[model samples]
Target chain A: MKNTFNILATIILVLSLSATVCAEGWDVPASVKKKQNPYELTKRNISSGKKIFQTTCKSCHGDPGKGNMLPLQPPPTDLGSQNFLVQTDGEIFHKIRTGKGAMPTFEKTLSDESKWMVIAYLRSLDKMKREAVVTKAVVNPEVTDVKIDIDVDSEHKKLIAELTGLKKDGKRVGLEGIELSFLVKRAFGQLDISGEEAYTNEKGQLIVQFPTDLPGDREGQANLLVKITDEDNYGPIEEKRVVSIAVPTNPKNILSERAMWGTRANAPIWIIATYVLGVIGIWGVIFLILFQLFQLSKMRVKSK
Target chain B: MTQKTSDKSRRNFLKSFGVTVGAAGVVSSFSLLGAAKAAAKEPEEMVNLLTADGQLVQVDKNQLRPTVTEPLNELQKRGREGIAGKSFVMVIDLSKCRNARKCMDACQNHHQLRADQHHINVLQMQDSEHTAPYFMPKPCQHCDNPPCTKVCPVDATFKRQDGIVLIDNERCIGCRFCIAACPYSARIFQWTEPKDSEKYKDLTYNIEANVPQKKGTVSKCLFSADRLREDKLPSCVSSCPNGVYYFGDRNEDAVTNGTTGVTVRFSKLIEENAGYTLMKELGTKPRVYYLPPKDRAFKFNGDLLNEENLH
Candidate 1:
């Protein structure tokens, strides 16, 4: 329990520190104002959309997709309704043909497996329907309740993380994807890891399996370090965490435990060195530039 | 110094104008300084997106294209996700729904939804392995307390004054944070550039009515707030066959399933009976309410589930 707390507390400290450093008030600096979407008003998008609407749905939904269901009394709900805008993509497509309640469906009415055109018409109507309107950054720290677990199929291995507890502050700068490095130590050299690569989800969980083609793994035998590299305020970044992976073997299929990694394969020293050098290189360049600029301004004032 | 920089880059134009910004690129330092004076402005090749956590990285103009479309409402304004007064919400009655794909198809057809990227999806859900299964079709809940809005760093997915949630793909950086934050898993990310129409082919991004969903962005149902503005049912509500979904203004105290109008106090309807919200523990305060399986139509059909449909 104490060890677990130590690990958990360390994780918390790292996270809070990250959050404090990247607070939005810290200001990410301003971004270039992007131009409006290119589709603001063009032919192919709007006209093609109209074409699809005209060809397929006009009969039921009505021209310009403003159709009614039963005869007159209850005007078919407007296709151009704001009420329709808030649904999930799956729900909308499912309802079109099967018919929800009063309305007759068009599963048979229109059949363009690719529904991109329909989505287009939906937007076009909104563009034409609503009143003319107008419109309107940051990165900070990453706090994590992060850990990794490995699951093994008789032939493969899975890596998982308790990343859900990881939190990114509201004002945080965005994170690049996670970078994980799998390694085993020198005392045992290298343990065979049938499949060595693992992938992390947005929540920070990871799972990986060695291809059956590669040798299956053995039980309880490797030291692993998962390195995660993400973007930092200063420059690009990379980080690391260590864990143990013990590949369990299958008695039924003895050879299923084909050898994968050589135990000595703990991440090479070069990777850490490279990471440190890269970070230093990036920070050094920025500092050097700032220093020179400071000196140049001083010289200008002196001359004056 | 700034002027010299522009003159060096814009030496070609200096002949015509006494002091000028050269136009090799649109956003050079000198040109930026003399921006007001120059009409022949170059298009800035890049823009920066500030992540929710406060990271600023420059993104090229080419990177922010079609996926960035206008929103149907003001859901993407700064500091506006879960912005009170912009309280969009929805209620899905599970007892009313069946395996009927009507709502899904209608949504697809109406939205001109692209394949592989469902604006809404039907979930064959069971809270636990022992629990009975039900057809749970998902649309953007337009939550009153939307987790999607809460986690959105740029306020790309936001609530509107009239209780609607919408996306402004233009302002969206496509980080998919909203997708992760949504417990209902109501949101979907565009893995590839949407096979959008030509109209969006030339327009630059603006925040209103997100369109031409770009690659690497999050999108979900917007509850057809535009339809509601015109006093019409949402495409899904109007399209469902079994009257499975009911939509209405809680303030007006009326709800309808496209064909039938069932008027009752919104609060009373939820309280008088066993209406429930999915994943209630998550505190999303979804707009959609479920009537439970007390008296459902059609036997619970587990056989209709194709494993492929589980996702």
Candidate 2:
């Protein structure tokens, strides 16, 4: 009886504590939510994980985050970039595993199968060492003219875009609506377009294309933009490139407070009216007294 | 459009009323009774026009035209009519904006934008100096959680049934409060007389018809109710040389730029990462999306400085 009472009391206490925790928000610590990097997975791992990207993560980030890159348009994330590469890979993986920010948390909905697959795909996006490029190539119908030279030693390779244009006032002026694609055909059809690349120039040349997760060949017909000039004057196609893709990643939280959102906060009309009326009332009384005194002085002067 | 509130013409209050605009108190008075004229003399309380239900409406007596401003009651009714039936939206492809004020000019011409009261302003913007520069043509975001409407003491600036936000300039008391409260910097205050062109100035004032710009009031890109009534894209959406603005009805759940007829579902587009509101953080939830400034068709240069990209 003594043993039974002790066990029953302990079970009741544990259950009550659990109930209290549930009533609260089930808060996640910032540190736990913060991304963990060293545990990042690799591309070979994520190739199998594409199914998870397709199902749970595809809604907001799209399949591979390939947004329409038309001029006067919003440029979707180039997940294939170095800035994105250096980020805590596992942190991103965890973000996909359990969403945060604008992304709905998937801890509850996703099965273990789906979560692991997302982990594999995110591992695939980490900047891989660019494969060495060979100067020589042959005509291959399967290959597009886009030339890409990946670095041999570095998993993360840098593509410096050198735009040739007339020197305007001693500065290299990047022309508008300029499209430059460099394609390098590698051995054994191992097509590598700048090793999943993204680029930005010192002189406002943002024409490089980023690979998104639609089923486009990684080897042949690589169409990466090098330079685009005054395409905004033309039409959408003139200055834009739309590559079909669908890679579901963690939400980028792009919809946060924009510049204009800051400008709209201020006072309403009733407060302003009250303030104006107060000023006017004071002035009105003052003006009335001054006018009466002036009239009295004028009459006295006339009598004198 | 829940049963399209076909302006249930109100029975003329006090039969008829005339309004004029001038500093003069007594101008061309045609009083039916001497007693009525005497009693009306110096009624200080008559300056601010109050509605039958105790809402304040500024009636510029001389400027009054024979048009009904959608009352607060009607606007509230429309708000109850959610996006379930139909909602029109515009998505601006930012990669295409050339800072060409084409949309601005179109808006001005359509709304008769006074020189001092520009409804649309194209701003040169960038996320950071490191990021590429781009031209962002700003119109009213027509926020999903509009702060302007929230702060309006009289509920003057109300969001409409068709997902457009407009002000009853007739009720706008020139407090300029709405001007401060708008996050988009979308509102424009008329400081002086509109100095409208001889032809445009003669047009009478109407709530739906944003014309005959009055002095000391606020205005902004209205999505041109006049045009929407005719089933046409807003001027800024259509006039752009670049197919940047995609306008469509949310009820239909599809958007189109006249030239690039790529129709996509609105919510789907938002989820697919092609669409987003302007300022999601402030929770204004603008209904426009931007395609980032990548390999833009128009380089961010002076060439795109036209009137078409305002939407």
Candidate 3:
């Protein structure tokens, strides 16, 4: 009777442990769940977030509600689903930062501001949240003859951008409400620093904190680019300034060593030597066999 | 007497050589030289010319129209060589490809190929019964050690320094040895005249483009050598709607995504994504690498699954 009771208790304990392991809810911290999105949900901010989602997130999660996600063992969640809508913005943000199973963690790939913008974009996708949050279209104003200037503050580690445009009567005025992007030039593309919400203030100045952890050249020189974010309104206006910041990086040369695939003149010495030896060996054997046959024929004739 | 004999002999030789200098014997022995010098001074009116039969003649310069020079020789010479200090590499991310067929269409149009012919083919591949199916876009591997170039009886098929395998159809003696040796089956023989043969007939054959594709010659992918000369991405790489292809110089160790136009370190991208080459055991050392299809979003369905499509 005691053995039967013990067995039942063991079975119940094992089952309970397995149930906890396979639980559906992600264990998000209470503080993380309450943290609100920092960026404003503007039209430009949402569009910027949309581009990021298309490039990075769409591969796995797919189009929000389409049910076209890659068929995995445990499928990726649909962002448009009611289950996702129920979760707070902080819960979703935490989930993205620390991924589970097949989903990759976005902490390294995306910046904090970029993540907030992505959340804003996701909120805009829901009709109820779109009406509540995305009420204003704070985009770049249509200003022609705009000139941009960039200055680096070494003491404060800040990048300041000043925008000025010509008025109809040839008067230069500070252009306000103009969006700008801060990017560092990389080998193949640019790395975005300024968030979607980075806009010129009433004084036509945008003061952004410079990131200290960028990879630069041997001299620790990094090319800093300040550009108008709304390219459609402003026709590719931008400025570049070189700043001494970030750690130095030495890129490895994949082709520094001699490769096997080269011109015939550059063929390896062993290959040439092997070819010569092979030719001699094959021909020598053939000649030896021919000589033996000739000797046998002479002996046969002599015997006759 | 010696000078007279030498002059007379020279006059006889000039006569035999068909010099069109009128009354050669009556003029001084240096008459041909004098006339050529006189023609050189008056370049506006007259020009000295050499005939095919070793005859020297003076012609009116006004009658001469500049003959249009053919660039075929120059094209062939440069086509055999490749861009220096650059090794091209291509990376295909199978996870992103949705079988759009836009890449295939762009390649065919760029190469002037028929609907049946393909420079790049999108194949629906299923490894096993339980495994998920995926679309694999196959092009010339452009192997470091090309079997096609080795089996060629003539030097028609060759590998360029930029890791591209090109077929000089002009030198292909209608032999299909290369086709048999290639394990990838990347090559095709122009058994019939290529599509739009008549339209491209007058075009000076560009060895890089491999068009005006001649019948009875083997033709395969050339990595868009002509486009590379202009520093543009290959047609198939540039046409992908999804960020499926990353192409760039291996020497620079960078690759740019076709869709995003973002450049990244080649080695880092390959290392992080667990990139692999096709048939690594074959020892072909293909320049093209592939990132495995991890989490594909779309259903893998194609007409290739039909019974009639099976060979």
Candidate 4:
């Protein structure tokens, strides 16, 4: 009986442990877990991975792989957590390729290289202390003289930001291969331009065309902010510029206001007058006939 | 004695004729006075009148005329004159919709609509078998030249200057003329008394809000005219998880997506997206425009195919 009791206790313990593992943990094969990631964590790969994550994963996994828990039944795993970070790249790759439960299979959607790049991007997030990366440049303090000039072309609806790198001698030179981000400040928050990150051209300028009808304030004024985000060479520099767009005017359709076909407000004066006159004229004639009939009845009584 | 009796009868007849003529003249003169009063400009003084129930009521001298109330009151008037200097417009991007019925739910809650009554409906549309299915949310087109308003004998349904079409439930006679005339089939008639709480039931009806909805009246989307007056986005626009609907003043040429808070050029969005109004051939000149379902975010899952399951 003592041996049986020990056996039963062990069996129950094993069952509960397995159930817990099945519920939360993935069942990755041994061979798949041992497989290695073939891609390197290069700057280009990390950026590409960021783009993919934003477009594909941000909706469910959130901005920094924190996992949006509201919509999912069994919430998505937090990719930034240590429990997730401890997993090998092969396990993650296999789980992504062959999805389980609520997670979708991304094998057909992402190429192997893209998958590896995304894994690298996820790995990089483990080092981030906060949700957003705020890089303060301590490298070259002399690059503080960079000036950003913004011009708006109303006809084409384009906003051009020109970045001029100024030397200590006060000479203007164009900076190349620097990433610039342009955003429009709105009432609620900032609206970033689609394809917001742009590298400076040969002229050291980044031009972005806005939608023609992008609304500004009540006065038709839009505020644009341009930032230079090159942490390695220069500190973060931001410039703000204001531009005015055409304000929409009221529609000029007078026919809508008229009361021709039973519009109550602006009914024609003549129609109301005619209707009233006709009612009075018809009623007067009927009253006159009724009086004549009464007069005739009196005359007949007199004759009798 | 016979001559005396005949004389008395003649006197009675004369008196009766005089009374009849006097009454007729008084009635006609009152009508004439009403017409004259309508033609005259506003008077500074107020007027007192006796109603049919023997109650004396004091009213504005201008309202003494039989013409429709010059300045519409809260209950008796149609809200045909929209908020001035505004022309509202909406744009729906079909590519972003994933049959999330949050817009409908929001509208129903805000409007206090019945289960069968939907001011905005999401329809499963497939142009052809080769094309992928997509969800199309249909609200009242709020046409500039609304056919529904034209057929309304009572002028209950009318277009406002701000590009909203509203129904005056107090004025609607339940003729269903507007319903028949509407090509979009946007209007819904309340067949039975609406199940409303006592609070809404006791409240006076406002056309802009269409709240405390009455039975045997036609109701459709008013584009949240009351909310517009408050300078807020419509319930559906703000409630959408996906940025499907955009609302703005066409006069402003800018439409903001309530979900993303991204304001875009209304004309440019329509032009670039090859946006088309529903049944453009009808020439309804709808205020609503739809962007095509190109490059959709998700595959058209057949979840909404059986709409009964959605309820």
Candidate 5:
């Protein structure tokens, strides 16, 4: 029985070992593969997608085409390679939406637009498309001069920002598809209140609801920061506004009290008190004994 | 003559008794061997299992065993470097803690700690005789004025610029000075070979997470320095089923709650919730904050209450 059991165990172990060596293919659904991306592969989409990729996909995938992907059982595909780029946009989209093996599903975390933007960014890494992207950049220089207009809607409790960019010809056009972030300035870092949705609409306007429950300084004042997230393309565009839209807070400082365990400057008074009182009490007793001895010596001299 | 006669009789009696006993033993051994053979012949129970290809098959239950852990991933080996210009802080809500011990479990798993050893402990707390009892999940406060760091004779334990306290086991002589210096009793020492010594023997020591733990070295809550590098929450912080933990950069002045994923102003959260540090009188200037158990999420069931939990 033991011999038979050993034989059976060995066979099963060998079978399991071999199963891991064989490559498994990703199953892309027919309906998903046929679906087309609605968004255009513009520079704006590519740039925004690049930013998303840096934050979300950079760690595992590494730099595209650099072959610096993390070492895993089934290695992450270098999106720059022809093997990955040959797949249909819909096929890539479905793969990203419904992840397999080590890759995580981004359907819930990212919107459809964000996924398309990532694809657009990934497609730009192609050798043929690279030259075209550069030529297009030179032909139409990016608008550097941009202005932000802040509007506070008190009745609606909304903070609004409008962005406009000036062309070389001096004509101002509302900048669309730009990502804007909202944060409340604190002592150390800015607290992001933009939540999930932060992109400006076609009119270059972004509106965020002012949280009523947010605790502010004594007079209920808070510094609100509205800034463009895509600084690489748009440059630095930030506007700071002081708004009274939070619950008033009077903070208490707990470091005021002196403690025994505190530093030399902030040491407890009890130790010093104990040392002084102890010295006086001990010396007083010694002096009293000496005085009695002196009186006894004086009595002896008088008797003599 | 009488003594010799008795001695001869005694030897003869012993020889006769031994012969009978040896025969009886041999008879019993044959029966015992037969019984063992019978037990082995009895059919082994088979467990039904589905293959990766979706085919169901029957296999002996003895074949089932947990697979060996995979090698360290890239993110785990990503060094103990602190994030520049960032100081991390944690705020624990006493009201939310229900003695679930999920945080403890996560911390232990991340650091490769034994079941008895804990990087974070959920302690039962009560102030006075009539006061309400609450659960307090205590981790290393990572004090700015840390006594533990000051007492490290070999400089094995040190504080980082990013407000994280880490231990280098490679440099540790295991004198246990930091363990004695810590007033909060946060540090623990490995008395014997660490849990899974053989499995993790090849793994390089991660200074930030303090894993593959070595024997005779002291380890405590690292505040998940490794996870912080990836802008992720600590194991204890993220694993809590209740919204008990809030972790963030002190430099950002914002802390995101583990369960709710709600980021709030550090000062405002403390002021509004009346958050206070543990052992304020000690002047350790702890980075960890605690919200008072004013309005609790769950009633004090005392499920984890025992002799050790008492004051």
Candidate 6:
């Protein structure tokens, strides 16, 4: 019985050791766990945190904190899970600041305030998840009323889009912290404004400098589109506005246009004149030689 | 008395001329006998010939001669003209390059060039010892005001409207004047016969493709003009894994990265990246622009030192 007990104990010890070895167990220090997050959970902090997450951590953590399943040796932790949420804010902050195994340490990269902001953002994600659940239970979620105002300043060469909306609570509010993608509807497809996703300001407005070279219709009219993409709280909303862009009267640059290296039609007058003269001179010489040869042949025949 | 002497001298010259004529007849008769003997063993086979003006004629096999002159075909004539309504441009982001040498390999393979001859070169550049090192790939600039085209006496090298500088090997006299004139050192001379297959030798010469490269002719990058005609990316641009090169029509104001398939506005990308052309002071007006090596993805490791050691 003692021998069997010894074998059983050995197997248990080996299994536990192998498990620890398989995944390098994260050891969060007691002191680190006690550390408190300093940043307040505000909308601005959450937005900046979201931006950082999208740029840096989203590649592995995915959009909603669901792990991307990238076949890592020890897979990434799902940040949105109940187990992850149960961890103290300090524990999450320590994990991000002092990375373990596959995760890289962002201590040198991110500041202390930024780390706290990320933690606040993580907490807000839990609220978003709860809100999403409550939203699904509602029979008919009222679509947010969205309005877009387009102004074309031809003198300054700027196209500005002013957006305002009414929340479901019957309150007129500026759609702050929402992404507004501005695009010019082209013949083939929509051309993105500056290839950048524009975000609305606190006043619910996004302004983009009109591209001076953007071609328009026959009447110099451009179809501009502003869209607020679908998210957890709001349904998708879009607005299209037609704006008259200034007709570009500037002439083409001389260097880019009819230069010497350009097409034959654009060849310089001097080159054409020289070419014509050279051709005529060579042909004239040839004709003159033939005429002289004919005269010499006649003269020789008379002498014979 | 002098007239009498002159008359005598003239009579003497005539007497000598008669003797020489008599000797020439004897020699001619002997040659005719030799010709008769040669004709006895001559082959009777005769070949038919078609004259250029559509006249059919027959000639002895010995009388048949090879034509020494041939005219340029349709493709060669059309090659001088550029594609209509297109102005090509290339932008290279220096921050993205890591001396992969894939562009050089692709260019060499497509051009059928030897190991020493490269149409694209990845050069290691460092402004100073204090500054960081970067890899700069140098290809033919295909300048809008190309110095190489100007010095070409035979018009062998010419620029097209679509922003490509091409070399017509048939017209190149191996003078190397364009090579001397080019500031970028982009041109290369084929000092020896190209080591190509017999099939390539039998294939018709293409001015755009520049395949079966001839000996003693100057050659440079054509921006893969033949490939451009097919609406395909240049070999170097498509082969690069780093998306260092962006090529597109300047008139359309768009440039696309061949590797990443990321299209950006030509003017905006240049403006945002602070793109600058090489040797702008020279006024060559190169179509290729370079984005400064800022915000590099990877550290400038000592790999360039290792590459230098290999060299």
The count of residue-pair clashes in candidate 5 stands at 1
**Residue-level error in angstroms, candidate 3, position B12:** 35
Off by over 4 Å in 1: A1-304, B1-89, B199-209, B305-311
Distance (Å) between predicted and true CA of B264, model 4? 3.5
Q: Which stretches of candidate 6 lie over 4 Å from their true place?
A: A8-191, A194-210, A213-304, B1-74, B195-197, B202-205, B305-311
As for candidate 4, its clashing pairs are A213-B265, A214-B265, A248-B251
lDDT by residue (tens digit), candidate 2, A1-304: 9999999999999999988965552244556556443323443234436655655455445645354222222233444455545545345555545554455666434544446556546545544532212112222222112222222211222234543343434444443222333232111111223232222243424333333331222231222333322233222221122222322223222223232212122234555568789999999999999999999999999999
TM-score of 6: 0.57
Candidate 1 lDDT, tens digit per residue, B1-311? 21233234433354556434444444466756475435325445678889789999887654454454443233323212222222223456676566677777777655546755576787777879898888777777666666666556654565554556666675578888878887777788777656665656664442333455566777677676546545567788777766567665553333555634443334556777678877778776677777775555445757566542222
Q: Report lDDT (CA) for all predictions.
A: 0.52, 0.53, 0.77, 0.75, 0.77, 0.74
Q: Give the lowest summed-lDDT range of ten residues in model 6 chain B.
A: B1-10
Q: What is the lDDT of residue B287 in candidate 1?
A: 77
Model 4 C-alpha lDDT per residue in residues B204-271, reported as the tens digit of each score? 56778787788899989988887887788888999987788998887656678988787776777999
Q: Is candidate 2 or candidate 6 better by TM-score?
A: 6
- Model 3 / residue B244 / CA error / Å: 3.0
Q: Number of backbone collisions per candidate, in order?
A: 160, 75, 2, 3, 1, 0
Tens digits of per-residue lDDT for model 5, A173-194: 7777667888886533467787
Best by DockQ, which number?
Answer: 4
Runs in model 5 deviating more than 4 A are A1-159, A162-304, B1-81, B305-311
User: Candidate 6 docking: what grade?
Assistant: incorrect
Interface RMSD, every prediction, one decimal place: 28.7, 19.6, 11.9, 12.3, 17.9, 13.8
Candidate 3: where are CA atoms >4 Å away? A1-45, A49-145, A150-226, A232-235, A240-263, A274-304, B1-70, B150-153, B173-177, B252-254, B259-272, B302-311
A1-304, model 6: which lDDT tens digit per residue? 9999999999999999999875666688899898876766655566667767766677877756555646676677676666677777888988887797789987645656767877777777674344422112222223367766767787777767666767678876666646666676542235577334366666777778778777554466777787764345355667788877734333234334555654344557788789999999999999999999999999999999
lDDT of 2 by residue, B1-311 (tens): 21233233231221233222331334533443455556556453424677889999875444434666565445434333322323567777776666667887888877777544567777788678687778887788877667787666654576655667777665567888888988788998888666554766544465554566667777777776666656666788878766678777654345667444445444565666555567789877786666665556543443344443322
